[model samples]
Target: MASVRFNLRLVAQSHWRSVHRWQPKRWLWGRARCCMSSLVGRRVMLTRPASQAQGMAANLAALQAVPILLPVIEIAPLADTSELDNALFALAAYDWLILTSVNGVGAVWDRLAELKVPGLPPALKVAAIGPKTAHGLEQRGIQPDFVPSEYVAEAIYPGLGNVNGKQILLARADIARPALLRLIEQGGGRAVDIAAYRTLPAQADPTGLAELRRGVDVIAFTSPSTVHNFVRLCNGEQLRFPDLPGKPVFAVIGPITAQALADYGVKPDLVAVEYTAEGLVAALLNYFESQPLRNSL
Candidate 1:
């Protein structure tokens, strides 16, 4: 895992320099009229879940690019909430409440509301993995006690301070990695991971699949599940990702997603250093600007 992360860092450093060199009139957000010309009229396929793809689609459209929505993964509340409900009712017993994604934040809050729990206990510290998750908590009038410098789950450990003899409750996806929980346990923290939600494969959208068959300029992935589900959907339709000319450029929001693509023998064309929708768009603009020929395709 260390070696994998090290390789990802190297790739990030290489891509960061390229993304840093470009300066669009309004890189991430502003009037579409002021956006860079490189992405104008280009078709970018967004592969996030339905609920989460809107922001990225809006961002792409605002940049004057054609956004094709193709939801690959669906986020749903788990049917069996008894386990999570029990965990939330005993929230005060835990020293920390760790949320790993915006979905997790939503699930935890929904359960809390259903259970009639007003809010988190005053003494319990809260940790959010990224700005987006932290912002979700903030929307509910809760301020996180800690957010790591890096957006990844592995980066949240140092901010947690001494966890010896501490009890931590992690509200995360059913398919979440065990890295964070293992780290906490190794530090003598009693970490209980509760499934806040389930990630399921989204039924393929006919329009989106047709657009993909015709070809797209770029395809963006935000998570491993998206990458996996995309390939699954394509395979069901007898389509395969190829390396021919005019093939869609594969762009990912983070190294983990990039690694997911790599696992399927697909190397990402760009990886966002910031690991957010805005960052992904910025990287796309920068990539197209750098490779002017891609703009024509």
Candidate 2:
């Protein structure tokens, strides 16, 4: 009986060890750890009172229960339509069409539809920097042939493989980073760039800004302009949730936006592993999962 009991204990210990090896922590615990870790070495600059900070956890809980409401912040035209038009005309002659943003896809499609340009070249293939742009293409009755698993300029560029002597047309925002275009040129591809759209800061909506100030559990900034506009609208007003510096989660889609947050003295709670809306959403979900204690409390 004693020997059997000892063996049973050993088996139980081994089982637990194997379980830990396979799943380091349960889902809830994992989230809590992530949230805690992200905050450990960060600084908090609360413009609000201590009571408001503590109330943030409760506000977050309530916000999580509600549906995500997205507000349109801005819409504007590209700086140079002539350049865009010329680029689209070149599209039918190029070997590849590379879209870096959903805005790019929309701009090109809208322009082409307006011009009634007929038929893309048979040799031309489309590539999107990320899933959002790919989905934008799908909505226009087109499909992207390539989308990288990781949605960053660096990641997407390498996945293009060799493009030596290939003609590639890149459509993007007026303020787009030059990394992808530089990479294409370096890879021996003849790259033509066109500014598809421009983004302007949205008019300040006082009511909406007040609601945002009241308490936002998670603030998502999709672009640098959004970050700039959001900050401009809010100014230096004290937020309802003060603990946010330590806990309130801020998510950004790309490095440029992430840097913008830092420049504004707003620490991001989560940075998307990739540069796309899909990746942003995934990163948010992952962040929520990591803060089990905060979520459960």
Candidate 3:
């Protein structure tokens, strides 16, 4: 009986060694499979009619291993359309158009379509803060002339290089932070700010939050509001494995969101080097690679 047990243990050890040898390729395959699985039966919620939720869905699909649970915090129209309309008109006059978020792009695009603004100015150079925002612009047939290597405003600020005397239009949410605008102004550029949309706090979805707490391995936060609202919704609830601070990683898009997590007393385990969904996905994958056994369990 002792000899038989020893033989079984040796076989198991050999099998594990083989698996370890193939770990790198297996990890890559696992990520690919996850991405494909995420897209199989997914439906994108299109809050803004003109919003490129489909494109966003495709982008999400490509990052399947990241485990993003998008419990939309809130979706609302631009509180004021007049200012957006004026901003679109001003777009034609400005030398540059800056888009800070996907929502900002959608709001501005919807307003432009409504007002029948001829076409984006031919000479207007477009700048986007991240790849997703840049993708939003591309879907509208406009290519961004400037996108930062990093997704944060601080990273993007220096890349603006020299915009002295440049007329720039920044289309963004009503409650968006003023970092971008402030940077543009500091660069000697005259910036006209327009509030394209407004984000209202969404009623906490208890059922959804419950499922997330129970099943999700990672939580991806795109903005500070999402983090704040999500935490508020989960207030009083205990996490599945609270003892492990990094068990279910909190992945943030950029420093702003990382700060938001910090403010809520939750430090993110991973933050994307770039502020786009793809970047977020890559960061998550890298984290998994570094901690394969933790992910497997």
State which candidate has the highest TM-score.
1
lDDT of 1 by residue, 78-182 (tens): 999999999999998999999999999999999999999977877787888766787787688676777775778878889889999999999999999899999
Compared with the true structure, what per-residue lDDT tens digits does model 2 show for residues 154-209? Answer: 56676567889988887777767788889889989988877788766555445545
What are the models' TM-scores? 0.88, 0.66, 0.70
Q: What's the candidate order when arranged by decreasing TM-score?
A: 1, 3, 2
* Sliding window of 10 residues with minimal summed lDDT for model 2: 40-49
Candidate 3, residue 248: how far the Cα is off, in Å: 3.2
Whole-model Cα lDDT of every candidate shown, in order = 0.82, 0.59, 0.62
List clash counts for every candidate, in order.
0, 5, 0
Clashing pairs in 1: none
Indicate whether candidate 1 or candidate 2 has the larger lDDT: 1
